[model samples]
Target: MNIRLHAGTLLFAVASFLMPTVLHADVFSPTMSYSYADGVALSPDVSYQFNEGIGLSPVVSYQYYEWPGDGVLQLSSSPRVSYLFYSYLGPTPALPTAFSTTSLPPTNMVARPRVPSGTQFLVYTSGAFASGVPLDTNKMTIVLTHGWMSSSDAWPKDMANVLTSQGFGATANIVAWDWRVNANLSAGLEISAARTPSEGEALGGELLYLLGANYNKPIHFMGHSLGTMVNCRAADFIHGDAKNSPGKIPGSTLKLNPQNTHMTMFDEAGAVGVANALSLVTYMLFLPTSGDTGDLINNFWTKVIPDHSAWIDNYISEVGRLHHEAANVLLWRRFAVPVISDISSGLHAYSYDWYSNTVAAPLISAIGHRFSFERNTLSPLPPSGTYFLQSADLIDSPFVVTPLDAATANSLSSGRALVYPTLQAYNGLNVAGNAYLNGLNAAGNVYLDGIQHAGDFLYDVTEWVLSDFNGQSAYVGTGTAGSTPAYMIPAGSAPLQFFWDLPFTLQKSTASPLALNGANGPIIHPADAGPDITNNTAVYVWLPVIVPSNTVGMSFEFKIVGAGTNEYMTMGVSNENYFTMESKFLDDGVWMSSGVIEISKYAGKQTQLFFSMNGDSGLPDGKLSVRGIQFLTVAPPTLNISVNGNQAVLSWPVITTGWQLEQTDALSSSNQWTDVTNAPGVLDYENTVTNVLNSGARFYRLKK
Candidate 1:
C-alpha cells in the first residue's frame, strides 16, 4: 500500500508566474453552481469557457458559517485542463509571448524518493490555500483535500515542499474542498458527514456541474482520511449524473470511484455503526487501527467480520452463492474449486475478546489519539474448536498462543532451530528465485531470502525459521512440515547498504560471511557498522535496499549548506576488492550532481553496492544528505546463436539483465516450442535444437 505519513506543520508561500499559451482549449473551463437560500447565493451565475486553452479570472468570494464560531471560510476549487502529453513527444519549447507554454514553476513539495514497487500510494499536502500554477493534469494533480479539524491552511507544508523540490514542476493543482468543522474529528464523524444524503447529494451536484462546465477531461483524485469520504461522495454523484444524463456528455472530469479513495478499511469499520457507537459510549473499547476511515470499514468487513451479522457478513458469501448457482450448467467447478479452498484456508478463529484486546485496543490508542472505547463485562466467546490451548511443554511446542509474537516466537523458542521444515515440502516444489513470484511483499521493500536456482525451483526466500515464532504458538504449523522448515527470517533481507560521506569512511566486512559489492569506488575495507568519518557530519545509505530487476542504479545527491563558504569532500562506491566509481569536491558546494552508472557491469549477477562518503576536508562540519536513487532499463537481448543437440543447446552472456529468448518452427510456427537448454542471466536460447534439426530449420528471436 502506498501510504503518505502525516507531514509536519503547514507553511504557506504565494507567488505568480506568466500564464502558458493555448495547447488544449478544453483545459481551462468553468465550474457549474446553483443558489438555494439567499436572494443571491454566495456565488453568482458566472458562466465561463475555456478559450485558447486558458481560463484566467480573479476569484473574489466571501462566505460565513454560523455553527462553529460563525467564522468565514474562504475557499476555491479551480480547474486546469490541457492536451495529452507523451514523454516520447520530446521537450516543449518555451514560447516567448505572455501566453508562453513554459512549464509552471516548482512549488513547495516533499517526497521520499524511494517507494516500494507495486504499492499504490499517494502524496498529500495542506498549507496556506493558494491558487496553483496551471499545467497538465495528466502528469500529476495535487488533490488538495482539507482536514476537518483545520482548514487547508493546516495541511503539512513538507509534502508540497518536497514535490516542488523535485522535477514535478507545474504539475499540481491546489483543490480546496471546504468541509464543515469537526467533520473529520473522528472516523464516525467522517462517515456521518459523508453519508448525510442531502448534503452529499449537493456536494456531488456541485462537483459534477463544475466538471461539465469546465473541460471534458478525466481527472485523477486523491483523498486523505476523512477526505476519502468526500471523494467517495463526489464519485457517487458522478455515477448518478452519468446514469441520469444518458447520452449527454458529462464534464471532462472523469469520476474515480474507490480508486481515488485510499482510506484504510479498518478505519471505515471502526466508523461503522456498531464500532462507532461502542467506541463513543465506552472510552476503553479498542478497535482495529487503520490508515483512514474508508479503508478501516472496507477491510474489516471483508477480512474480519464473517459471522458478525447476516447481511453484513454475507457480502462475500453472495459472490460464492452466485458462482455455485451458475455452476450447474457452466462447469464453474474449475474456478469454484480454488475459491472454496481459499475460503477454507482462510478459516480463522473469531472472537470479539481477542479483537477488542489485541487488534482494537492497541490500534485505537496508537492511531485514534484521544478517542476511547466503552468496556463491557460480556466478552465475546471464541468460535468452536478455536479455544486457546496451553502447552504442557513450551520447549517442545510448535504453536505460539499469543497472537502478536506468534510468528516471531515460533522461530526462536524452538530448542532445535535446524530441526524445522525446508521451504520445498510446504509448497510441494521449489518456488524461490522466480522473478514472477508476486503477491509477496518483496516488491514493497519487504525482503524474503534471495533464491539461487540451477533448475526448475519453487520456494520462499527465507533465512529465519518458523521455529522462532514458537514464542506465541500462533504460527505452529505455518511453516513447511519437513521440506519447508519453521525457520524465522530476519527483519528484512540483505544487500543491506551502509553509506557514509562525512568526517570518515565506513568500514564493512561480513562478520558471518555477508556478501558485499561496490560502485563508483570503495575507499575503505569491509567491517561491521561503525563511524568512519571524524568530522561532525552524517552519512547515508538505502536501508534494506534490494534490486527489483537485475539492472539498477544507486547514487546520492548532496548539497553543502551552512557557514562553510566552500566545502571539501570525497564520495565513492566499492565492493570487497575494488572501487568502481568516485567523485571529489573542493569548491563552494552548492550544486547537485546526479549521474547514472551501470551496477550490472561490475556486480554481475547479484551484488550489493556499498556507498561511502568522506569529509576529507571542509569549511564547517556539514553532513551529506542523499536525495535520490533509482533503476533504469537496458536494451533487449538477442537470440544470437543456437546448436542442435540432444537437449537443444542455447548460449548467452552471463550478465545481470531482464531479457529472454524463445524459438519456434519455421514451418510449424503455430506449434509451441519443445525442450531447451539455458544459462543464468543469459539472453540467448536454442529450444530443442537437436529435435528441430529433424524439422529442417527453426526460427528464433530474443524478447525483452
Candidate 2:
C-alpha cells in the first residue's frame, strides 16, 4: 500500500498546542423555553406520544405537545404558558462513545456507533458564523480532522477558522470533526493510536448521514498526521460497510469510493495500509516535517544520499534529517521548491500551519491554487489525482519537468541493442546463417558469400557517418577512401549549398586517363561490368541557389574527367521548368566553362542549378566521372548621379570600380551613345567625376 501525504506545511512558527479547556455539560439535557410572538395564533394544548425502541416497548415514551396562539400578547406568565413542549421518559442513552468526556461511561455504547460528540459542523456566511447564521447544505462540504495528541479545537478549528475567514466562508460547509477523545495522546501514543480506526468508523457514519441528507454534494476530507490515517481507515470502513449492506443508507450515492471521495493527508503516520482500500478521486500528500531516521531508510537513503556514513550520522541526529530530506524531495519533485522551513518543532505540526494559513487561506483570500480547485473556486473542492502540495514562494514559479544528468544521458546514447525473434530471412538466408557473414568492400557495400541468387538483395550505397552497423544489411561508412564514398564536404567548400546524387563509388586509381586533383574520385560504369547491376541510369547533381535581388548574371565551371561512347553530360541553371546556358551533349573528356549566363530575371528567387549525365547503350565497360564544379555571381551596378543647375556629379562605390560610364540620346530606334570624357577620381571608396548635362533627356548607364 502506498501512503501518500497530502497536505503541505507552511514556514510559520509552530505554535505550541494549547491544552483544551474541557467544558462540562449534562450528557442528556431536557429543558423548555418559551417566547411570545405578537399576532401569533394559539390552539389548545395538543399532544402526541410514541414509544421509541428496537421493539415495541412501553419503557420509553416520547410526548410532543404544542399550543398555538395568535394576536398581541402582554409580557405575562399566561402568554408564556401557551407554548410548545417536548418530553421524554425512561433512562437517557449514554452520549456517543466517540466523544471525549470524563462523565460518560467507558464501555462501548453501540455495536455500530454513529455520530461522535463535539462533532458539530459550523456554518460560515461570508467568513463569519456569528449568531443566527444559517447553514446552507447546498454548498460544498469540507471536513477537517486533527492528528494524534491534537484536538479538533487545535488545528481542525484553526483550519475551519481559516476557511471561513478566508474565501471559502461564503461557499462551503466547513466541518471540524471533533474526535478528540480518540485522538487523546495524553492517554499514551499506543492507546490513542489504537482507537483511531474506530474514531474513523464513527466519522464515516456521520459523513454518510450528511451525504444522504445533502444529495450529490461535493465533500472533501483533509487530515493532518494521524488524522490522515483516521480518514483513510474511515473511508475504507465506510466503503466496506456500504458494499456489505447496500441499502443501509437510502438515497445516498456516496459510497466512500475513490470516485466520490477526496482526501488530503499531511505528514501521514500510523499503520501503512489505512488508505489502501480507498479509491479516491484525488489523494494528496503534503510532507513538511523531515529528517526523521525512519523515513530515510524507507525512502532508500543509500541510493539518493552519497556517503553512507554521513547518512547514518544525519539519521541519528537529534534533529530529524531523513524527515526533512524526504520533505525536500517531495517538494522538489512537485517543482515547488525554495519553500520556507519551520524547524521550531521536531514533531510534524507545520502541515496545519502551512495548509490553513498558506494553502487554504490564499484560495479564499485571492483565488489562488487555481489548478487545485474546481472552476478556480474552493467551493467544489479539488477533483481526484495525486497532488503534491507545497507553499510556493511565488504563484508562477518555474517548474522543472526533467533534470539533466550527463551520465544517464550518455548511457542512453551508448546503450546496446537487443535482438528479437523474427521470421523474415535476408539474402535467402536465415538469421543463424547470416550472422557469420563479414567483410565490407571499399564502397561500403556488403556482399553475402555463397549466395546463388545475386539479384535477391538491393544495395543502398548512401554515405553514413557512424561505424556501428548491426541490424542493417548495408555497410555503414567512415567517409574515407577504401571505405565508403564521402557524401558531405567540408563547410564553406562553395557559397551556394550543393548536394550530390550521382550513382558512383569512391575509387583510388592513378591509372585514369584524365588528371583528377584528389587521390580518388567517384567512378560509375555499366551495371553488368561492375559489382552492382544497373539499367540506363541517369546521374544528376544540383545546388540550391538564393539569387540575390541585386544579381546580374551567374558563372560556373565544370569538367568531365572521363566518359565512354554513348555517355554524355549537360550542365546548366534550371528552375525545373527552364534552363540557362544549357550545354549540348559533351561526350568528349574536357573541361567546360559556362560563359556568364544572364540570371537577373531569376533574381530574388529560389532556384537550382543542375548537371545531368546519361549513359546509353554502348560498350559494357562505358564509364563517366565529373569534377571541378564551381559557381560565381555578378552583382548589379550601383551608380548615383546628382544634378545641381547645369553641372552633375557622378559617383559609384568601389564595387563598380571597373565599370565605365556611357550616355545615350534620342527617343527613336536610332540612338547614339558616347563615353564620358571626364576622368574619374576615387574619394571615400567611391569613384567620383563631374559631368555637364548639356543635352536634354539623355539616358546614362554603367557598362561592365
TM-score per candidate, chains pooled: 0.22, 0.29
Per-residue lDDT tens digits for candidate 2, residues 148-197, read 55666566656676666556756666765566664553322333433454
Score each candidate by Cα lDDT: 0.25, 0.34
For residues 454-475, what per-residue lDDT tens digits would candidate 1 score against the true structure? 1111112111111112122111
lDDT of 1: 0.25
TM-score of 1: 0.22
RMSD values for the candidates in order, in angstroms, are 32.5, 44.1
Best by lDDT: 2
How many clashes in each candidate? 111, 30
